[model samples]
Target: MAEMKTLTAAARSGTGKGAARSVRREGRIPGVIYGGGDAPEPIALDYRELNKLIYAGHFLTTIFELEVDGAKQRVIPRDYQLDPVKDQPLHVDFLRLKAGATLRVDVPVHFINQETCPGIKKGGLLNIVRHSVEMRVPADAIPDAIVADLGKLEINESLHISAVPLPDGCKPTQRDRDFTIASIAPPIAAPEEPGAAAAAAAAGKGGKGAPAAKAAPAAKAAPKPKK
Candidate 1:
């Protein structure tokens, strides 16, 4: 289950870029909350606090309960914009989540027991195809991450979406095919030994089709002057 976080915000009466700029000048981030069958509400959050949360990571997957002017709104962060240069939070969008609502979100995939994987023990490489998967999950039951266990995987073997255990009422977005999540690739070739490589090179140096060194010119006949 996703852990819920709480944020405090204040209603903002103004709208548009100028108003948003004014809010930012005052050290606040302007944002909006919509959906859940209600009119969108404009609000502002403390810049420092919001920045901290944004950088801390996993802001989108976790649910946030926004306390806006004494009314608490349960929402999930859907989108956000950042300054291209500084990477600072510029604007945010939150979707108000009502009870029983379902959300389609990308949940990160976490590989476990990799050190104990049989394939890895045998010098095989683990190739990940999908780092995360899109899931349609209930708002209250969104998983923090999906686990992919590699302990028993063997070389040339693969794990598919159907093998993973998902939260109740959660389903993968890709239902048409059982897609591969990861695979154990064949081991990389070991480097040739220096002595062996040298021996092979020497053998091939004069092998078939190789041009032979030109014979030394025949010694000139002894000068006939003495005769």
Candidate 2:
């Protein structure tokens, strides 16, 4: 399960573009918390602290205990925007987690036991179909990642969602089919032998391997009409 993160935020009394700009000028990130049948709350967080979590690469999936004005609220990141030029955080939206609420999250995929996989030993390339899977999980049961084992896979074999062991109360958002996660493909073909290539070229010249019929001797130019 993903570990809960703690973030400190302050309630914002100001709202709108000018207000947000003023907050940013002070090195804070503007954000909001909505859902759970409660009124939306506008807030702001320290830029330095939020930047660290954003760069850690798992901020979206990890649950957070947002401390706002001495009150803690369980929430998960729903969306965020980044500055087009500087790539800095521009705005953020968080969703409040109510008891028994199931959240849909895209969890990263991790592979294991590659060295022992028969396909890898035979030079098969591992082709990943889905690098991450969307899962519907209870707020308290979100997993860190979905692990795919490649130990028993052979060349041309695939690993599907059903083969993976999901955490308790965690289910893939895709329920219609058992989708492929990854596969081991046979090694690419080697270059053709020189002799075989020469033989094929010769055959083409002789018309045996040609794709088109030789033009009928250019149809003897109809005897030029008598001048």
Candidate 3:
């Protein structure tokens, strides 16, 4: 189970790109909260606080308690827009949730026991195909991350998304196919052989010397004919 985060927010009286830019200039982030049969409410959050949550990698699935207009509301992050260059949060969309509501969220995957894996010990590379997976879990039962153990995986073996153990009442959105999450592949071998390369260079020089000797004989014959 994951711990819930509490954020303080204030209602925004002004809306529009200009107003949102102004809010950002004031060191705040513009956001909106919608769902639960209510109209969307425009809001602003402290940029510093929001940045901390983003850095913690908890903005997507963590349940948040938003203090809005002197009232506390439960919400989950639905969508977000980021500045391409600076990678800063530009806008955020929050979905209000009722108690006991089940929501679908993408949670990051964490792999364990890499050192104990025989394939990794034998110089195999671990490839992570999917960094996150989607699951339907109760708001309070959302996990911070899904853990997959690779202690017994051999070379060319894989751990699928279905192998991940989910908490009770939580289920993966994927079915009918066991999606590959991670795999161990053999290391790439070096292409060039040092000894073979040296031998080839010597053979090339010997062949060049033979051609030079034949050219010398031809030059001598031409001079004799001129005489």
Candidate 4:
């Protein structure tokens, strides 16, 4: 298991959109921590630290140790809002967790060994249906990613969520029996003409061919008799 990252947070006394905007001006992100029968604590974090974790792409699955006023709290990111234009973290919601508690989280699915896939070698394309899967796991045992091996898969075949190997104590949260994760299919080919080229080639061979017999010419005397 990977180690959890620790971040510094401060309890905020103010609330509301204006207050949050003011906090952002000072390079802080406003957040809230709720769950586990405790009162929700409104907090603020340094923008630089939060940006680093967001950029790492592990904010959802990775456990975070939040230090609030010299007290340590274990939590996971539940929800967050991003600035539409700036693409920066606007606000975050953290759910407080306890040790040995079962938590549900979405884990990223990564495909491996595409170069060795027979389908891809035969001019087929790979399509991924689900990029991540939800699983129920202990808070401490959450996996970073679920790997799917595509080396043995042939064209039109797929691997489902149930077929993936889960880490110890982690199971898929999906209710269905089989959920497709990825598949490969044959590539489409362009259409070609068959008859026009043959006719053009035959015409270029020769203009003259065998001729048939002519008819008799006995009607020429009737015109002179009328005159």
In terms of lDDT, the best-performing candidate is: 1
TM-scores vs. true structure, each candidate: 0.87, 0.84, 0.80, 0.82
Task: Supply the TM-score for candidate 3.
Answer: 0.80
Residues 74-101, candidate 4: write the lDDT tens digits: 9989988989998899999999988788
The better-scoring model by TM-score among 2 and 4 is: 2
Winner on lDDT (2 vs 4): 2
User: lDDT scores for all predictions?
Assistant: 0.94, 0.93, 0.88, 0.88
List model 3 lDDT by residue over 160-211, tens digit each: 8778887888888887799999999999998879988877887888554334
lDDT tens string, model 2, 1-114?
889989999999999999999999999999999999999999999998888889898899889999999999999999999999999998999999999999999988999999
- For this target, which candidate reaches the highest TM-score against the unseen true structure? 1
Q: Tell me the number of clashing residue pairs for each predicted model.
A: 0, 0, 0, 0
**How far off is model 2, as Cα RMSD?**
8.3
Q: For model 3, what is the C-alpha lDDT against the true structure?
A: 0.88
Give the Å shift of residue 105 in candidate 2.
0.4
TM-score of 2: 0.84
Better of 1 and 3 by lDDT: 1
Once fitted onto the true fold, the runs of candidate 1 whose alpha carbons sit more than 4 angstroms away are 190-227
lDDT of 1 by residue, 136-220 (tens): 9999988989999998999999999999988789999889999999999999898999989877887786754446899999998
The residue pairs that clash in candidate 3, if any, are none
What value does the lDDT take at residue 177 in candidate 2? 100
